[model samples]
Target: MRPFSLRVFVPSGDPTGVLIATRDDGIGKATIFSRSLLGEVKGRKEWNLPGIYLLVGPSKLYIGEGDPVGKRLEDHAAKKAFWERALYFTAETRLNKAHIQHLESKLVKLAQEAGVVPLDNGNTPQAPALGEEEYAFVENVLADLLLMLPLLGYPQFEASEVAAASSDEEVDAPHAAATGKRRAAYSAMPRGLLFHSTSKDARATIETVDGGVLLKAGSIVASEPAPSFDVWMPKYAQMRRQLIESGVIDAQDGRLVVKQDQFFSSASGAATVVRGVSSNADGWIGADGQNLGDLLRQWKQKNFC
Candidate 1:
C-alpha cells in the first residue's frame, strides 16, 4: 500500500484559521471521518457526495473515494483491514490507537506544505480548498493506499462466503469464523428456577458455584442471601429446549436435580445468549449480572464490530 491521505475542512468562523483534519485514508479506506455542506450546496449540480468504491481485476483491486489529487497522503499500513473486510470503515479513535499518533503528525505536515491555512482561534476547521492538481494527487494516494489493505489479510473470507449460498436441502447456517465452530456450541434452554437480588455495595461481585450464581453486594450485608430457584419463567423456554436436546436433563423427571439445573443454565443455555464458544471458553449467559457485564466488555475489547 502507499501512504494514507489526509483531508481537512476549515471551519466557517475563522480564516487566518485553523485546519482540522476531517478524514485520513490509505486509498478508499479512511480513518478520519467528515461530512460536507457541498453535498447540500444549492444548485452546485455536478458535485456529488463522496463515496468509496473498488475496481477489481483477476488478481488486483483499485480502491478510492473523493478527489485523490486534493488529499494529503500519510500512512496506509494502519488502514488495510477495514477497506478489505468492513462493510463501512468507521472506528472509534481508541480502536486505532497504535497508528493514530503517527498518522495525525504526518497530516499536520502535509497540510502546511500544501499552503493550507488553519482556521485559527483553536477551534476545529473546515476542509481546505484543493486545486485540480492537488485534488487529483490526493486521490491517487488514497486509491493506492486502498489497494494495499487487501495484502494485509484484511479480507480473509472469499467472495463465495459473502454470496448467499443456495440450497435445495436445508442445512445449518454458516457462522462467522471468529468462533471456528460449525453450529452454535450451545442449544436453547427451558424456563426454570430463578433467583433475583440487589447488591448495595459500590463494586459488583459475583461467583458461580454448584450451578448457581452467587451475588455479593459489598460488606454491607453480613452474609450473601440465596434467592428461590424453583419458579420457572417463559423467557427460559429456549434455554429449557436446549437442555432437553442436549440430554442434560429429562423433562419428565419430577425430581429437580441440582445437576440438571446447573447443566441447563450454563453449558446448555439458549443459543441466542451464547455469543459463541471457543476451544477453552464455553460462551453463554452469565449467572450473575456482573458476569454478563464482563462478557460484554470482553466482546467490545476485541472490537467484534
Candidate 2:
C-alpha cells in the first residue's frame, strides 16, 4: 500500500466529539460525529453538500446518499434508534446526486456481502451511467472513503478472512512454509497486521485494527467461557454471552463457530473470547512465527519512529 498522510481536525476541541478527517491530495473529506453531537455538526456547511453517509451501531450499519446530507441524517436521528454515530464523505460540491447514489450502492452492497454487520438498508440502487472520467472520479472517491474507515475504528467493511485467503503470500506462493497451524497473515489496510491464535480444539485468526483486534468469521472458538474468565474478566464474559445470544457466534450446535467478523476493544479481549480463558494477545503468533506483540512493536518503531 502506498503511504499517505492523514490530518484529523477536532472542531469541537473534544477528542470524542466531531472529527473531520482528510488525506493530503485526496479527493474528499470525512466528517464524523456521535448522535448526541448531531446538533453541533448539523449546522456546518459541508452537511448541505452531496455525499454518502454511514450510520453505525454496535452490530449494524446503514448506508445512504443525500443530495444535502443533513436532511437524511435528521430523519435517521428521529427514527433510527440503532445508530449511535454517523459519518459522511464528501468532496465539497464536486459530487452530484448520481455520484453519491453510486457510492452508497457500492458500500451497502459490500457491507452486506461481508456478512459481518447486519445492515439496515434492504435494497441497493443501480449505479448511474457515467463517462470514463466520471467513473474514475467516483471510484477514486470510494477508495479514499474506504481508507478513512479505520481512522474511526471501523474495519467491518474490510474482511480480514477474505483478504488473507486471497493474499499473495498465503495463496500464490507454493513453497512458503506456514509458521503456525494456520500461518496466514495478510494486511488489507494500514495497522492491519494479522495473527493466529489457537487452543487444543479451537483455532482462530485475527488482525489488529485501529482501536482493537478483529476476530475473523468461521473461526472455531470455545463454546463455553472458562470459570476463571468469569472471575477475572467479567466484562468480556458478559460480551461473550451477548455475542452468543445475538447469534454472532453460533452456539446452538454445541460447537462455537463465528458467523461474522467480530471486533473487540483490545487484543486480549479478543483472545479471551476466542480461547475461553484468561489470555494475553502478546503471545499470539503471526504466519512468520513472530509474536503478535513483537510484530506490532516493530511496526510502531518503523512507522512512528
Candidate 3:
C-alpha cells in the first residue's frame, strides 16, 4: 500500500458523536454521524452537493445517491429505524448527479456481491450513462471512499484486503480532524492487533479496531452455548440470541457461521460469543502470542506511561 494520511474530526467535542473523515489531498470528504446527529450535519454545504450515501445499522444496509444528499438522509431518518449510522461521500471537485448515480450503483453492486449484510433497498438501480473520463473520475472517488470508510468503524462493503484501509472527513466545516497512517504495516495488520480463538467445535479470528474489536466474517462459531454461558456474560448472552434470531449467525451442518464482520465492545465479549462459553484472555491468542489480558495490561501501562 502507498503511504497516505487520514484525518477524522469530531464535532460537538465528542469523538463518539458526529465526525468527519478526509484526506490531505482535498479530493473528497466523508461525513459520518448517528441518526440522532443528522440534524446537526444537515446544514453543511457538502450535504447539498452531489454524493452517495450508505445507511447502516445492526441488521440492514441501504445505499443511495442524491444530487443533494441532505434531503435523502432526512427522508430516510423519518422512515427507517434500522440504520443508526449515516455515512456519505462528496468530492471537492464538481460531481454532477450522474457521477453520484454511478457511485450509488457501483456501491450497491459491490455490497450485494459481498453478501455480508441484508439490504434495505429492494432493487439496485442501473448506473447513469457516463463518458469514459467521467467514469474514471468517479472511480477515483470511490477508491478513496473504500479506503477511508473502514477506519471510521465501518467495514461493511469493503473486501478483506481493502477493509484494512483508513479515510479523509470533518464533522464541522472549517475544522480539522485526526490523522492516521496508511502504510504497509497497516495493510498487513489493519488495526495493529489480531487475535485468534479456537475450541473443539469452533474457530475464529478477530482484530482490535478504532471503536472496539471486530470478529471477522467466515469465523466458525460454536453452535450451542455453554450451560452457564448466560451467567458468564449476561450482556453478550442476550446479544448472541438476537444475532441468531436475526440470522447474523446461521447454523449449517452443526456449525454456526458468521456471515459478515461484527464489532464488539471488547475482546472478551467477542471471545465469549465465538467459543460459546465464558472467556477472556485464555480464550483468545493475540498477535504477539500474549493473552488478551496480558496485552490489555501492556497497552494500559504503555498509554499511562
> For this target, which candidate reaches the highest lDDT against the unseen true structure?
2
Question: Which tens-of-lDDT digit does each residue in 1-305 have in candidate 3?
Answer: 34678988876789878888888765878899888888789878888888889999998899998878888998899898899888998874667888889788777777775677888999988878766567557766776676677787767765433211011110111222121211111232347477788888889988767645688888999886753344334456667877876888888777899888987756666777787665664556876777655655454455444
Task: Give the Cα error of residue 135 in candidate 2, in Å.
Answer: 0.7
Tens digit of per-residue lDDT, candidate 2, span 146-227: 7778777777676444311211121122353531211222232356677887787678888677545688898888865543
Q: After best superposition, candidate 3 residue 217: deviation in angstroms?
A: 42
- The TM-score between candidate 1 and the true structure equals 0.17
Candidate order (TM-score): 2, 3, 1
Top model number, TM-score: 2
Q: Which segments of model 2 are wrong by more than 4 Å?
A: 163-305
lDDT score, candidate 2: 0.72
Candidate 3 lDDT: 0.71
Taking all chains together, each candidate's TM-score versus the true structure is 0.17, 0.54, 0.52
Tens digits of lDDT, candidate 1, 202-256: 1122333333233322211112111100011112333333444464433233421
Clashes of each: 42, 0, 9
lDDT of 1 at 228: 9
Cα shift from native, residue 223, model 1 (Å): 36
Q: After superposition, how far is residue 258 of candidate 3 from its true place, in Å?
A: 42
